[model samples]
Target: MKTLWDYTIVLQPDNNGTFVAYVPAIDGCHAWGETPEAAQSELENVFEMIRDEYIEAGQALPDNVELVASHAR
Candidate 1:
């Protein structure tokens, strides 16, 4: 059986020429990179770690969570 986890990536400029990727849903799941693609790859790695931790702890994972991106003023 497989499940889907919703993730949102927000890019924020850092002090240097790099950017930081923030994943709010997952704790301690943030990554910094010189480009967006690199940040995304790092985020994937963080996500895998989170998933593994949950599985090892025998926790009940939630169903597919969809991330809805909307602009609100």
Candidate 2:
């Protein structure tokens, strides 16, 4: 089964010159890396985790969740 959910990844600079990614929809779900690519990779893992949790909790995942980039701001 394939399901989708609205997720946002915000990249912000950290003190160590690295970037940290924050997923707003999943509280406390964050990742940090030296590059944007790495940060995004981490975010993908976070997304999978959240998806699994939602399924286990019997929550229905959306058939298609459109992410509005503007709203992530």
Candidate 3:
């Protein structure tokens, strides 16, 4: 079972009054909603579906990329 910390989710607002969320490490793993909270909730569903697909095929989830800030202002 994968934990929430296993992946990094990027949530951004769109110009059209909606929010978009996606996992950088997983292709096609994304969702959109009217708010940031909604977007994240939808993203959870998307990730679960993708995770199950990988499991049924006996594959491990891809490791999340480490994001670090190299510089600070």
- Tens digits of per-residue lDDT, candidate 1, 6-34, equal 64556677899888886665567788889
* Candidate ordering by TM-score (highest first): 3, 1, 2
Best by TM-score: 3
lDDT of 3 by residue, 7-28 (tens): 9888899889999999988899
Candidate 1 residue runs with Cα over 4 Å from true position: 1-5, 60-73
- Backbone clash tally (model 2): 0
Per-residue lDDT value at 9 in model 2 = 58
Which has the higher lDDT value, candidate number 1 or candidate number 2?
2
- Residue-level lDDT of model 2, residues 1-73, one tens digit each, is 4422255457888899998987665665688889987987887787778779878999864443335655554
Give the alpha-carbon lDDT of every model.
0.69, 0.70, 0.88
Selected candidate, larger TM-score, 1 vs 2: 1
Order by lDDT, highest first: 3, 2, 1
TM-score per prediction, in order, is 0.67, 0.66, 0.85
- After TM-score superposition, the amount by which residue 66's alpha carbon in candidate 1 deviates from its true location, in angstroms, is 10
Model 3 lDDT, full chain set: 0.88
